[model samples]
Target: MPCGGGESLEGDAAIYRQLLSISGHRPKVVLICARATELPCEEIAAALLALGAGKVETLTLGARTDGEKPAFLETVENADAVLLLARQPLRLSTLLGGTSLARLLRRRNAEGMPVAGSAAGAALLAEHMLAGGESGPTPRMGGVMLAPGLGLSNRIVIDQGGLLGDRLGRLLAALALNPFALGLGLDADTAAFIGPDNVLEVIGSGALTIVDPADIGHSNIADAAHNAPISMLNLRMHVLVHGARYDLDFRRPLG
Candidate 1:
C-alpha cells in the first residue's frame, strides 16, 4: 500500500484493519523509520499500537553499531508485518542498501509477510524510485530524478503526497523514461492495495491517479534538452476513488 503521508493513521484506518486481519488478528509489526531521523519512533509506535497491532517495535537504522545490526535483522525477519514510514526515499536507500535488513525484508515479503509503506516508504518498494523532482506545471526532461529502490515491484513506480504538491509531472516523467512501468500518484489519505496479481483496489478519502504510457503516440523525451519541457501524445490516465480497482497487467480500470 502507498499512503500519501500526513495524518495517514486516521486516513488509512481501513487499510490498517485489513493489514491487521492479514496478520491474523494480532501481529508483530516492525516499524522502520530509518529515513525520518528527526521523527520520534515512540510516537509512531504508539499510533501503530493504538491501531490494533499486537506488538510494535521501532527500529532506527543509522545509529546501530556493527554488533547491533544482527539483532536488527533478526527483529525484522521475525515480524508479521513491516511498515516503512514517510520520509526521503534516498535516505532509506542509503541506510538500508546492501544491508542484511534489506535482504531479510525482501525475503519476508516473498514469504507472504504484509509490507506497507507511506510516502517515501512506498517509493522505496519499487525497483525504480522517484527520488526528487519539481512539482507543478508540465513535466521537464531533467525535472525528475530516478534512482535504485528496494526492488519490491518492478511493474509500478510510485509518487506519494502528490495531490497537494501537484506532483503528477514527476510521475509522468518517470513513466516517460520507463514506459514499461505503470505510474501511480497517490493523494494524501489514499492508498492502493496491490494484490499478488497486481490488481490494485483503491481506498481512503482521496483519489488515486493511474498513468499508463503503453500506447503513447509521441514524445520528445529521448531528444529533449536538459530541463526542457517534454511533450507526449496518447498517454492514458485514470482517476479512481474509494472502492475502485485497477489491473496493472491490462493497464485499465477494473469494473
Candidate 2:
C-alpha cells in the first residue's frame, strides 16, 4: 500500500503501478470489504479494471447470504492479489478473526499473493494492531489500545487513524507498550507498500511516520500514573514522504 501528503492523480497512478507490479501484471484482484454494509466500491473496482486487472471480484463477508462458505476460500486461493477497503480495522478483525476466510487470506499472502489495504484497512495487515484510541497531543495512559492483527505483516505495528490530526501521542503509546514492533502512523491518503525484500515504499500525497523503539534507554510506561503522560527516552523516528524507501531489516532509509 502507499501513503503521502494529499491524494493526487499522480499519487493514485503511482499506487496502481506498484500494485500492478506486486501482483504480477494484469493480476486477478480480490477486493475484500471489511465492513458489513456495501462499501461503495464501484470507483475502486472501475480503477482496477481500467488498469487492466484480469478479474476483479468483491467478497463482502457479512452482507452475503452464503456466509463463510468454502467457495470463499476458493475465491481467495484463485486470486493473484487482494485489497481491503476498511473503515475500522478493530471491528473488521473482530468479525474475521478465527474464521476460515481470515486463515485463507493469510495463507494466500504467505504463498506470495500481493495484499494491500487502504488507510484503515492497512491497520490489520500487521501483527501488532492499534485497536482503538482517543486522539491527543501527548502520550498518556489509556489513550491507545493494541490488539493482535491478521498477521499479514509481523514486524510492524500499524495505526491508521487521526494521523492527519497529529496522533503521534497515540502511536507513541502503542510503541511504549509493544516496544518490539515498529509503529507506522499513517495519514488517510498515505499508502505504504512493504515488499518481500522488507523495504517499505511510501506512496500517495500524504506521509507516514515510522517509530523505532530499538534505541530506547528508559521508559516509564509501565510505572507511569494512569492517564498521565509517559516519559520515554531515545525513541528513534523517521518521517517519509512519497517515493522515499526504508529498509526494514536494517532500519535505515535507502537512496
TM-score of candidate 2 relative to the true fold: 0.90
Compose the digit string of candidate 2's lDDT tens values, residues 1-255: 523322443446567667877787688998887545334566677777888788889877674333378887888889998887777776567767768788888888777888887656677788777777878758888888888777887788877776545678888888888888888888756688888789988876677789999888888987988888988899898888888999989988899
lDDT on C-alpha atoms for all candidate structures: 0.80, 0.76
Clashes of each: 0, 14
Cα deviation of 36, candidate 2, in Å: 3.1
lDDT of 1 by residue, 96-197 (tens): 766677778888888788788876888888889888899875888998989988787899989985563478888888888998899889887777888878
Candidate 2 runs further than 4 Å off: 2-11, 35-38, 63-67
Model 1 TM-score, 2 decimals: 0.93
Query: Where is the poorest 10-residue window by lDDT in model 2?
Result: 2-11
Q: Spell out the clash pairs found in candidate 1.
A: none
The runs of at least 3 residues in candidate 1 whose Cα sits more than 4 Å from the true structure, single-residue gaps closed, are 63-68
State how far residue 145 of model 1 sits from its true place (Å). 1.0
